[model samples]
Target chain A: GGIITQTPKFLIGQEGQKLTLKCQQNFNHDTMYWYRQDSGKGLRLIYYSITENDLQKGDLSEGYDASREKKSSFSLTVTSAQKNEMAVFLCASSIGLANSDYTFGSGTRLLVI
Target chain B: LAKTTQPPSMEAYEGQEVNVSCSHTNIATSEYIYWYRQVPHQGPQFIIQGYKDYVVNEVASLFISADRKLSTLSLPWVSLRDAAVYYCIVTDRTGGLSGKLTFGEGTQVTVIS
Candidate 1:
């Protein structure tokens, strides 16, 4: 069984600071995605990578940048953290098929002070 | 991407059956319905996906209507650990990053002892 590992399970950043979240998947999937979930709300897609070095912006891509450094690694960067901004960032991967199932990481909880 | 609607919350007791319904009035013929659940402080986990008719897996059973406008996820013998938010999403045949899966506020299911 493969696992999606997210680094720094908890993050605290100052207002206007830049933050980066990293994800690693052993599934060797061809597609990776980053999603943000606010407290008491559903998740919103931030960005996704279809292959290495390929990036696609989702509905919530503003203020965020993504990097598909390799096939198994995808990173998300917050350009400028807002004060009191708190959310959980989730990483997921899939085989890039028409019926491939998605695997998700535990998540990175971010809190901006 | 087809919009989905689910209940805000539902309550159930241990060993009881829990059925959550989702409505997608404008679902396309090529679209598929998917279910996912999220526990506290964790990322969403995929449960099941189906194009039409009924589909079952060890974790849950999905029943889709003839018109594909409605689908239900049935969880048998609920337990406390099953308490979480359940999401229903509809996406096209092109899965992965190209599918553009959108997650709306899902149903919060509380399984009590």
Candidate 2:
């Protein structure tokens, strides 16, 4: 009965350029997450927020920055795009970890040249 | 985060039941097994999850062994739309607030007519 919306279905950036992806969830979930998926690979966590103004670093948060300015929105910024990089970034939200009630948004496909 | 292992690929025919197994030899006591599917150009969708024994939902069923070391997700009456990459994950669900999801190389399931 809820939906997560991600902006910019496709992104094209130049090498060393800064790119950003945004996500909005109307599920009123308490936790939000960002994951990146490379070709033929699994999803990797980038960052997460348990509540508004709370940020946590994930395994692959090195070159990324995240913000939870509002409970309904979470944003991810790529510090510097790598050349020839292509990947899909997903946004997900959940009420709690107790059950697997996680919901995801259509991902943003990023391509750097 | 307990690591998960699943087949790289699988195939099934329409109207057939497809079962994908996952192995988590070192799963912890408080961990849970979750299954998600990702259609091309879409975000991953939650299918089912189980802590122990068997759990069923409208879309799929999750079966866990007594030892909790292995689990299976069964999707009945498969169709062409069922073709996608399936991911099995193990995570701690204590306090109803698990951190981020750790994904592995999922199983690419192909449903043929």
Candidate 3:
């Protein structure tokens, strides 16, 4: 019965600019994840955190940084925005380490001009 | 991580039954088949998950054969709102501690009037 909330539904940034997306979950899950989805493509993992102050990189984590400031919040930063880049960033959380079901946020649509 | 294959797209009429299949030939004993649905401009939502046999919830039913090489997500009485991209994911048991969930090019289900 908890919800995952992502701030700034839409973001428009210039090339080389830095942008940040934030996520909060009330489920008290131990695992939090960040994923990026491009047009006509499936999602790719960006970064994730298993606990507060813990970080883990994923396949597409080169251009991003993540922070788990607290148990209820996780944030992602686009180090440097690329021109013509447009994608949706999603945040999700799960309860345990094995066979956990994930709950996701609505997503933040980013458009880099 | 086990690789998964799913249909690119499917079309169904309202009130019809729709079945989307996913093939994971290398699925291991510890791996689980998970189904998620993503509406346009939103994050994916968990539909169902199963290791083998059949599992059903209020949203959808997951059917896994004895061999566990393939799984099917059945949506009964499809409605307009059911039009969305459905993703089948195989979780790596060892990677959950890092909060990673690999996603494939999900099957897009379009409900026609």
**Candidate 1 residue lDDT tens string, B1-113:** 43898999999999999999999999988788899999997888999999999999999999999999999999999999999999999888666554766778899999889
Q: Per-residue lDDT tens digits of candidate 2, residues B1-113?
A: 44888989999999999999999999988788888999998888888888899999999999899999999999999999999999998888764324356778899999889
Off by over 4 Å in 2: A97-99, B95-99
DockQ of 3: 0.63
| Candidate 3 lDDT by residue in tens digits, B1-113 | 54889999999999999999999988878788889989988889889988899999998999998999889999999999999999998766666433256788899999999
Least well predicted 10-residue stretch by lDDT in candidate 3 chain B: B92-101
What TM-score against the true fold does each predicted structure earn? Answer: 0.96, 0.95, 0.95
Considering the two chains of model 1, state its CAPRI-style docking category.
medium
True contacts kept of each: 0.71, 0.82, 0.69
Which pairs of residues clash in candidate 2, taking residues 3 or more apart in a chain or in different chains?
none
Candidate 1 lDDT tens digits, A1-113: 88899998999999999999999999889988899998899889999888999998888999999999899999999999999999999999888846436788999999999
Report, for candidate 3, the interface RMSD. 2.4
Better of 1 and 2 by lDDT: 1
Give the per-residue Cα lDDT of candidate 1 at A76.
98
